[model samples]
Target chain A: MTKYVIRRLLQMIPVLIGATFLIFAMVFALPGDPTANKCGERPCPAEYVKKFEEEHNLNDPLPIQYAKYMGKLAKGDFGTSFREIPVKDELSERYVVTAKLATIAILFETVLGIFAGVLAGIRKGKFIDNLVLLSTLFVISIPIFVIGYVAQFLLGVKWRIFPVTVNANATGLDSWWQLLLPGLVLGSVSVAYVARLTRTNLVENLRADYVRTAKAKGLTTSRTIGLHALRNSLIPVVTFIGADFGALLGGAIVTEQIFNIQGVGGYIFSGIHNRDGVVVVGAVTVLILVYLLVNLLVDILYGVLDPRISHD
Target chain B: MSTISTRRGNRAEAAAAPSKYQPQDGLLLEVDDLFVEFHTDDGVAKAINGVSFDLRQGETLAILGESGSGKSVTAQAIMGILDMPPAKIPAGQVRYCGHDLLTMPEDERRKTRGPEISMIFQDALSSLNPVFPVGWQIAEMFRKHRGLNKSESLDRAVRLMERVQIPAAKERVKAYPHQFSGGMRQRIMIAMAIALDPAVLIADEPTTALDVTVQAQIMSLLEELQQEREMGLILITHDLGVVADVADKIAVMYAGRIVERADVYDIYARPGHPYTRGLLDSIPRLDQKGQTLSAIGGLPPNLTKIPAGCAFNPRCRMADHVCRTDLPPLREVEPGRESACHFAEEVLRG
Candidate 1:
């Protein structure tokens, strides 16, 4: 298992290089100059442009520039944004908030999603089943921004239940409290997907031959559904949940924007608008690393869920 | 149908005052006029129609039929594991130890499943949960029903694995179902079925999924277990060769009804029903090599639209107007033999 994990980690090196290169190329290819509008409402002077170009290695070919950037990245230097603020400091600050939001979203989706799914699966075609089906469908069809705004208006403004926007400087429990609404909004669609996936898998497993054998073994309906059927059903559901967690960690763009929470999505958003290649490439690189690690964890978990799958 | 009503009346009285029922005259199970139907999109398919049989201690009764002949349905009904909405028992009485299982409280009926009556299905691989270790699956019986602790249950599971003749029981207890070969997996299934020493063990085409040589081993193992516990064994299979040596008596089903029933030796020597005779003729004989094998004509009737009168009339050589107009009830053709045919005596004479 250790060898397998090491191999997986090594495999990520090529993927990380490819992904970062693509983002860097795209950001550089933007139809504008990075040095424009520097030193206020006008183009920089000829000497200033030359000195800036030389210092940042912008005068070199694209490949040579990328190589220089990578050399600094290897030493943990994320470089500075166009505004002269360190990209590394910006990312470090935002990542904690994003991670906490992702954690809360995952927990909310997993607990409620699985619970609703199991109930709907066992009582298929019943009232609760129909309710879950209709509600999930309703949630899935609507876009996230709409739900986020609507929730904010009703629960925060109208009902006086929560803060309309997250307090950016809040820490610990207070931060979590302020982020709760946005977190749930981010997780809403995933909850629908998880619930539906879990329902479909659970219903199928409930009809499996082994479940019949369990019934013949005198297991109560609860034990038969809970232990025998549910265990097998969760295999695919867990895979979905794991992948969704990685995506969530990348951050919800529209959600962070509406709630005004400082997160990776906002950083990437402003970087794209300003055509700041360093900020865009740096933030996305971290997202890529996080996604790869989570995928590896999911694969390892697959082995544990199903005895048939072996890591070796 | 009249006999079924009388039995239902008796069961009604029995259900009024339920109690801990005891076996009478060694009778372990009695399936009386059981009917199972599935309400599908196409129509209600009559799976089992007026099927009835009984088992006594140490007795082996083999139910023989082709696919969809309600043999497996009967077993599932007896086990109380049939999916209810699609599959419904419109009328039936499954009596275990004089207690009517069909009418008994669900909790009470469930309690009887593993300890009093257990079943082993056709495909052992699919029937066993894929993710669980073989021993843990076996140990579940002891843990849940007997309230044994984890270690005690696991110890019992190892012993059961050994009892089923699985080599290296201790080492293989942690092995998953997919790790074992087909025959060994079937043995594990058998081990689980016999774990609590059930009074009646139903083997639903148990050896049908195994090899020829392995089939014999499983059959003999089942026989030995039956004799040791004097358990009533119901072996449901379509294979005549598998049933010949192990079954004391045989029930041949056609279109969800028993077409013929007699001692295993007698039925093989002279089949009273045309369907039984056709089944016997289809079996390949070494003495008759190079000859074209004879098979029953056409196909088993679709459950939704079984032929009028005798269900076998469509394929029977002796079928006439009388065969098509009247459904023949299973009647005694000899002192100890019963056949459901208008001309049972003529078939028996031939």
Candidate 2:
């Protein structure tokens, strides 16, 4: 198992490198002048363009530019923005905010989704089961931005329950409460998917012959369903959680923008729109790394849940 | 009448009125007039209609029937494990040690389930929890029912594995169900079933999924265990050959009812019901190698709309107009045998 974990960790290096390279290549190919974009509509002198190109190595070949970026990245520098602020300094705080938001969103999604899913699975074919299934489908069909806007309107604009846009200056509890609306919007689709996946797997597990055996053993209803059926049902759910973690991080873009939260999602989104290569590629690389690590953790968790799944 | 109870031979209650309890020498488990029905979209399925049987301690009662004959359903009802809603026992009494289990509270019934009466299923592979180790599953019975601690229960689990004759049980206790072979997995199931030293152990087609040699081994192991524990054994199977040596009394089921029941010798020597006779004749014999095997005519009746009167009448060659019009309740055909057939005497005489 240790060897398996180590192997997975080592495997992440190539994946990260490949992901970064691909983003870099795409950014390199974009038909625009970074220096000119930075200069805005102000008529730039030819010397200023030359000085900007020289400093930023924009005149070099794409491969050489990529190597230079890698060199700076290896030295723990994410390169400076066109406005002269270091990308690392800009992303670090946003990264924490995004991390907290994703964490809370996923936690909410997992807890509520699993609870509803288990209920649906146990009461399969009943009214409650149908109700849960319909709601999940409804959630899945609607887009996140729409969910965000609707949530903002109902809870923020009309009810005045929460601020429509998160407070950037808030600290601790105030910050959490402010982030709640965006988190809910960001997590709505995931909750639906997780609930659906969990319901499907749990319903199947509940019907398994072993469940019958567990009942025959005189274990209480809760013990049989929670311990035996639920554990077996979690493998697929775990897989979904792992695969969706990456999506949640990347997909938080719209929700963050809607709520006006200055998180990595917003950082990356504006960077992509403004064609800020350093911020875009850096955030994407970090997100991919996080995704890879989550998947690895899920595989390890799978091994723990099912003894038959040995790492060897 | 309340009797003063004493524990550890406390003399304080010794002068109280004599205990109302008296030892009765009779059956350990009895299913009287059991009627189980399943309500489905089509209609109600009369799965087990008036099925009756009795099990004595240290004796093996085999309920034999073809697939879908409600043999397993009867066992499930006895164990109180059948899924309700689809299944409903509207009329029946499952009396265990003079206590009606069917009407008992769920908690009391649960108490009786693992510790008093346990069951092993046909497909051991699917019956055993896949994620847990075989020993841990066996130990779970001890932990939940007996309140044994983890380490002690694990020790008991190893002993049970060794008792069931699994090799290297100490080491294999950590092995998962998928790691074990089919025979070994069945052995584990048996180990779990007999863990609590239940008064009655229902083996539902326990050997059907195993090879012939392993089948014999499992039967003998059950026989040995029954002899040691003196527990009532209810072996539910469709195979006529497998139960011949192990079962003391046999109840041959057809269309969810016991068609004939007698000693193992009498069942083979003289079958009182046409269905039982047909089952015996269909068994492949060495002398009948070249001849076409005899088979019962027509399929078993649909449970939703079982044919009126005798369920076996349409399939019985000797079925008469009376057989088609009247359901023959199980009646004494011999001194110690019962048969549910209009012409049971004639069938038995031949």
Best by DockQ: 1
Docking class of 1: high
What tens digits encode model 1's per-residue C-alpha lDDT throughout A147-170? Answer: 999999999999979899988889
**Runs of candidate 2 exceeding 4 Å displacement:** B1-23
Clashing pairs in 1: none
Give model 2's clash tally: 0
lDDT of 2 by residue, A182-257 (tens): 8878888889888888899999988899999998899999999999999899888877776676567654778888
- Which DockQ value does candidate 1 get? 0.82
Chain A TM-scores, per candidate, are 0.98, 0.94
Tell me the tens digit of each residue's lDDT in model 1 across B1-350: 12211121332111222324446777889999999999999999999999999998779999999999999999999999999989999998999988899998999999999888999999999999999999999999988888888998898889889988999999999999999999999999999998877778999999988999999999999998887767789999999999899999999999999999999999999999999999999999999999999999999999999999999899999999999989999998899999999999999998
